[model samples]
Target chain A: MFALILPAVLVVAALLVGPMVLLARISLNQYSATQLMIEATTAQNYLNAVADPYYRGVMLTTLVMAFICTALTLALGFPAAYRLARMESRWKSLVTVLTLIPLLVGNVVRAAGWLGLLGNDGLINATLRGLGLTSEPLRLVYTPGAVAVGTIAVVLPYMILTLSSVIESIPRAVEEAAANLGASAFTVFRRVVWPLALPGTVAGCVLVFILCMNTYATAVLLGGSQFKMMAPAVYDQFSKGMNWPFGAALAFILLAATLVLTVLGTALLGRRYAR
Target chain B: MGQVRAGPGPDTVTREAVTRMRAAPLSPLAAPALAGPGLSVRLGRLAFLAAVFLAYAIVFAPIVMVVVTSFFDQEIVTFPPDGLTIRWYLNAWAQRDFARGFLTSLQIALAATAIGVPLGTAAALALVRATIPGRGFINTVLLAPLAVPAIVAGSALYMFYLRAEDWLDMDIKATLGGLVAANVLITIPWTVRLVTASLAGLDRAAEEAAANLGARPLTVFTRITLPMLRPGIVAAALFSFVASFENLELNLLLVGPGRTTLPVAMLSYLEFRMDPTLAAVATAQILMVTILMLVTDRFVKLSRIV
Candidate 1:
C-alpha cells in the first residue's frame, strides 16, 4: 500500500510542494538589478507590494472584479441549476451536455471567442450598427465589462454544475410537503430548498470566486494591456520585469487572498446556515 | 387555495393526488407545485424557461461566434458585408508556428496523461483501500495543485527549475522535459479527483473474496480492481489530456521561446493581429473537444465522475 502511493507522493513533493516552499523563501529575499534576486531575509518585497499604489490598485481591482463575477454567476446559475435538477424532459441531458461544453473549451479559446463577439469589428458592434442603434462602434472589448462577461462565462458552468448536483439530492417530497402546507412558491424555496442547498451554493461560490481571482487568459484577452489584475501582474513581474522577489511576493499575496477569502466565506456562510 | 389543508379531508386528499401527479416524472416541465394554477403561474413558468434558455445561449454564444467569424470571407472580420469562405482555416493551417505549437502541445499532453494517470490511480487506491493514517491530509496535498493559481505555480516552477539547473549543472527551465513535468503535476490532480470519485462507488467484496480464496494481492488488483476501474481510468486519461492540451497560464512562463504550445502561439498571434485565423483555430479546438467528449460519453457517463 505504501509502495503504491510512494511515486505520487515523491512527484508532488518535488514538483508542487518544493516549488511553493522555494517561492515562500524567495518572497522574503531582496531584488537586485544585476543579480535578479539576492539572498536575504527581509520583508521589503511584501512591503513594496502592499505599499505601492499600482500594485495595491491591481489587488483591489482583482478583488472587486472577482466579487462581481461571483455574484453574477451565482445569480444566473442558481435558477438554471434548479431548473436542470428538477427537469424531467428529454432535453435535460442535452442541456446538461451543452453546459459541459464550455468547460471543455479552454479559456484561451473561449477568450478568443469573446474577442470575435466583443471586439470593435466583432459581432455585437456589427449587429448594433446593422440595427441602426448606434452610429459608431461601441468600445466593448478591453473594458472591465467585457472582462466580467468573459470571466462569468468561464465560471458559470462550474457554479451551475455544483449547484445542480446538490439541488438534485434534496428530495422532491420536501418541497411538495411545503407546498401542501399552503406555502407559496417563494416561501417553499426560502424555507426548504434554500436552506438545503446552502452548502452547495457556498461551495460553488468559493470555487468560482477563487477561479475568478486567478483569471489570467480571460483578463489578458478581454481586459487588454491597460487593465491590471493580480495574476497578470505576477506574470509581468516575473517574465518582463525580471523581479523575482517581487513576483514571488505578489504570487504569495494572491494565493493568500484566495485562501483567506475562501475560508472566510465558507465560515460565514456555514455559520449562518448551521442548524 | 383553501382546499389543501393539513387534515386528511377528501379535498385535501384530492389536492395531494393532483400535486403528486403534477410532480410526476412524465411532466415535461415538472416545476415544484408551490404555485396554484392561474395565468400568473403560467407566465412564471414561461419566464423561468426563458431564463434557462438565455443562460444556455450565453454559455454557447462565444463558441458559436468563433465558428461564425472563422467563415467571414473578408481579410478583417466585419459582420454583415462579407461572404463565407474556408480560407481562414487554410490560413490557420499555413502558420508554421501554429503547426509546430500544435505538435508540441500534442506531445506534451500525451506524455503528461501517460505518466500522471497511473501515479494518480495508485495514490487514489492507496488512500481509499489502505488503512493509512493522515489519508485526508495526503489527499489534500495531492489535490492542492489544482487549487494553486496556475500562474503562481508556473512561475514558482520556473524559478525552482532555474535554481535546480544551477545545482545540477544542466538546463531544465524552458525545456520540453521541464514542461512535461509541470503538466504532469497538473494532470495528477484531475486523475486523483476522478479516480477517487470512481473508487467511492466501487464495491470491495470482490477483492475481499479474492483475498479469502488465497489469491495474491497483485493478482486480485490486476484482474478485478483494475478491470472495474477501467471507466474511471479512461475518463481520467481523457480529462488529463484535455487539461494539459488547453493549459495556457501554467505553460506560459515555462514554455521556451521556440517551443510555444498552441494556445501560447494563439495568444502571441492575437497580440499582433485580430484576424479570423485565430477564430478558425479556436473553432477546430472546440469541434475536437466536443467530439472527444461525445465519444467518451458513449462509453462512460462523464456526469458520474466529473
Candidate 2:
C-alpha cells in the first residue's frame, strides 16, 4: 500500500503544497519582474488586495460566475444523466459517446468555436439577420455570457460521464421496485434514483465547480478583452502586471473559496446519504 | 394512432395508396406508427436529440470552419469560395516555426511522459495501498494542481524560477526544460488519479497467488501488475500528451521570445493575422486530435485516457 501511494504523495507534495507554500511565502513580500522586492514580514500584499476595489470586484465576479456556471451545468447535465441511468445501454452508449466527444478537443478549441459562432458574421448573428430578427448585429462575443457558455461546454462532459457511470452502477431493481409499487416515474426518480445517484452527481459538480473557479482558457477566449475572471486576473498580475506577490495573495484567496466549496459539497453529499 | 395520421404521409394518399405504402420502405414518419400514446413524447424526444446533434455540430464548428477555410484558395474566407486549393497547408508547411515548435513540443511531451508515467504509476500504487502520515494532506496536494488553473501554476513556476535561478544555479524561465517541468507537474495529477482508480478496481489476489508461487515482488509486479495496468498506462500517456500539447495558459506564462508551442503560435497568429491560415492551423490541430481520439478509441479505452 505504501509502495502504491508514496509516489503520489511526493508528487502532490511537490506540485500542490510545495508551490503553494512557495507562493504563500512569497505573497508576504513585494516580488516584481526584476526581483523579489522583499519587504519581509509584511502583510502589505494581502492588505493591498483587500483594499483595492478593482481586485475585490474581480474576486467577487469570479465567484459569482463560477457558481452560476456550475449550477447551470448541473441542471442541464441532470436530465441527460437521468436518461443515461434509466435508458438502455445501446442508446446510452451513443448519447454518452456524443457527450464525451467535446472532452477530446481542448479548452481553447471549444472556446474558439463559440467565438466563431458568436462573431458578427458568425453563425448566430447571420442566422438572426437572415430571419430579420435584428437590423444590427448583437454583440454576443467576448462577454460574460460567452464565458459561461464556453465554461459549460468544457465542463458538461465530465459531469455527464461521471454522473452517468455512477447512476448506471446503481441497482436497477431498486428503481424497478419503486416503479412496481405504483410510484410515478417522477416519484421514483426524485425519491429513489436521485438519492442514490447524488454521490456521483455531487462529486462531479464539486469537481467541475473547482475547475470553473480556476478556469483560464475559456475565460480568455470567450470573455475577450475587457472581462476579467480570477484566473486571468491572477495571470495578469504574474505576467502582464508582473506582481507575483499580489498574484500569490489572490491565488490563496481563490484557493480558500474553492476549498470551502469542495468541503461543503463533499460533506453535504456524504451526510445526505448517511441520513 | 392520431400521431400516425398526422405524420408526413402522402397528403394525397387514397385508401389504395395507404395499402401500397405499407409495402414500401418505412419512412421517418413511421415513428408514430410504432409509438403509442407516448408518440408525442417520443417525437419531442427525437426532436430534442436532433437539437443536441445540431448543437454538437455548432460546438465543433471551429474545427469545421478551420478545415474549410484552410483549403480555401482565395485570400479571404467568405461563405461561397471561388476556388479550392491546398495553399495554406503548404504555407503552414513553409513556416519554419511549426517544425521547430512541433519538435520542441514533441520532445518535451515525450520527456514528461517518460518521467511522469512511471512516477504516476508508482505513486498511484503507493496512494492506493498506503495510509501513511499526512496521507490526507498528500491526497489533497496530489490532486490539488487540478484545481490550480494551469495559468496560476505557470505563474507560480515563473516566480519560483525567477527567485530561485541563483539558488539552483539554473535558468528555467522561458526555457524548454522549465516549460516541460511545469507541464509535467501539472499533468501528473491526471495520470496518477486515473491509474489509482483503475488500480483500486483491480483485484489483489492475483498478486497474492503469484507471491504464493514464490515469485519475487519485482517479477510479480512486472509480469502480472504491469500487464494488467497496461490499459490505464496507455490512457495516462494519451491524456498526458493531449494535456501537454493542448496547454496554452501555462505556456502563455512561460513562453519565451523564441520557444513558442503550437497553441501559443496560433494564438499570436490569430491576434495579428485573423486569416484562414490560422483556421488552417486550427484544422490541423483538430484533425490531429480527432485522429488521435479515433486511434486511441480503437486501441485503448478512450474513457480510461480522460
Candidate 3:
C-alpha cells in the first residue's frame, strides 16, 4: 500500500507542497526596486496589500467579477441541467459531449475566438453594421463584460455537469407524489426540487466562483490592461513589476479567500442537508 | 382548503380516489387517454427545452465560430468574411515554428500522460483500498493542485526550479523535462479523480474470488483488477493528455526561446499577427478532441463520469 502511493505522494510533495512553502517564504522577503527581492523577513508585502488602494480595488474587482460570473453561470446552467437530468432520449449522450467541448478546448484558443466575435470589427459589430442598426462599432472586446462572458462560457459546463448529477439523483416518484397531493407543479418544484437541488447549487457556485476568481487568460486576452483581476495582477507583479514578495502575498490571499468560501459553503449546506 | 378536508365527506373520498388514480399503473385502455402530457404542459416543456438548447448554442458559439471562420479566405478575421477557401489551413501548416512547438507539446503531453496515468492509478488504488495512515490527508494533498491558481502554480514552480539548479547543480527549468514535470503535476488531478471515481463503483468480488482460488496477489491484480480498470485507464489517459496539451500558463513561464508549446506559440503569434491561422490550428485541435470524445464515448458512457 505504501509503495503504491509513494510516487504520487512524492510528486505532490516536491511540486505542490514544496513550491507552496517556497511561495510563503518568498512572501515574507523584502522587496527592492533594484534587486528583485532581498532575503529579509517582513510583513510589509501583506501590509501593503491591505493598506494600498490599488491592491484593494483589484481584490474588490476580482471578487465582484467572480460573484457575477458564478451567478450568471448558475442562471444559464440550471435549466439546462434540470432538462438534462430528466431526459430519456437517445441524444442525451451527444448533448453531454457537446457541453464538454468548451472545457476540452484550451482557454487561450477560446479567448482568441471571443476576440473575433467581440472585437470592434468583429462579428457583433459587423452584423449590426450590415443591418444598419448602428453606424459605429461597439467597444465590447476589452471590457469587464467580455471577461464575464468569457469566464461564464468557460465555467458554465462545469455548473451544468454538477447540477445534472444532483438533480438526476432525485427520484421521479417524489415529484409525482407532491403533484398528487393537490400541489401545483410550480409548488411541487419550489418546495421539493429547489430545496433538494440546493446542495448542488452551493457546490457548483463555489467551484465556478473559484475558477472565475483565478481566471488569468480571460482577463488577460479579453479584459486587457484596463481591467485587473487577482490572477493577472499576481502575474504582473511577479513578472513585470519584479515584486515577488507582493505577488506571493496576493496569490496566498486569493487561495485563502477561495478556501474559506469553500469551507463555509460546505458547512452551511451540509447542515441544511442534515435538517 | 380547511373546509375541503374538514370531514370524511365527498371531498375526502374524491381526494382518495384521485390518489389511487395517480398511483395506479396505466392500463392499455388508459394509455390512450394519457397519450402525453397536457398541451399547456407540453408547450411549457418545449419552451424550457428551447431555452436549454439556446444556452448550449451560446456555450458552443465561440468554438464553432473559430472552426467556421478558419475556412474564410480573408487575411483578417472579420465577420461576414469574403470568399471561402481552405488557404489558411495551409498557412497554419506552413508555419515551421508552430509545427515544431506542436511537436514539443505532443511530446510533453505523451510523456506526462505516460507517467501520470499509472502513477495516478496506483495512488487512487491506494486511496481506495489501502489502510495507510493519514489517508484523507494524502487524498486531499494529491488533489490540492487543482485548486491552486494556474499562474500561482507556474510561478512557484518556476521559482523552485530556478533555485533547484543553484542548490543541486541540476537544471530542469526551460527544458522539455521541467515542462513535463509541471504537466504531470496538473494532469494528476484529472487522472486521480476519474480513476478513483471508477474504482469506487467497482465490485471487489472477482479479486476476492481469485485470491481464494489460490491465485497470487499479483496474478489477481493483473488478471482481474487491471482488466476491470481498462475503461477508466483509457479515460484517464485522454483527460490527462488533453490537460497537458491545453496547458498555457505553466508553459508560458517555463518555456524558453524556441521551446514553447502550441498554445504559447499561438499567443505570441497573436501578439504580432491577426490572421486566421490561429483559427485553423484551433479547428484542428477541435477535430482531435471530437475524435477522441467519439472514441471514448464508445468504450464508456461519457455521462457516467459526471
Identify the superior model by DockQ, candidate 1 or candidate 3: 1
lDDT of 3 by residue, A115-216 (tens): 888888888999999999999899998899999998988998898888887777666555666765666555766787778777778878888888888998
Off by over 4 Å in 2: A1-12, A31-36, A86-98, A131-133, A265-274, B1-35, B38-77, B80-84, B96-99, B129-137, B204-206, B298-300, B303-306
Best by lDDT: 1
Score residue A28 of candidate 3 by CA lDDT: 98
Superposition error at B70 for model 2 (Å): 4.0
- Among all windows of ten consecutive residues in candidate 1 chain A, which has the lowest summed lDDT? A168-177
Interface RMSD of 1: 7.5
Over B168-187, each residue of candidate 2 has an lDDT whose tens digit, in order, gives 98877778777777777756
Error of 3 at A72 (Å): 1.1
Per-model TM-score versus the true fold: 0.93, 0.84, 0.91
DockQ of each: 0.48, 0.22, 0.44
* Candidate 2 backbone clash number: 12
For each candidate in the order shown, give its overall lDDT on alpha carbons: 0.84, 0.69, 0.81
Taking the tens digit of each residue's C-alpha lDDT, what string does model 3 give over B248-293? 8777778888788998888777655556888899888888887887
RMSD (Å) of each candidate, 1 decimal:
5.2, 8.9, 6.6
Q: What is the DockQ of candidate 2?
A: 0.22
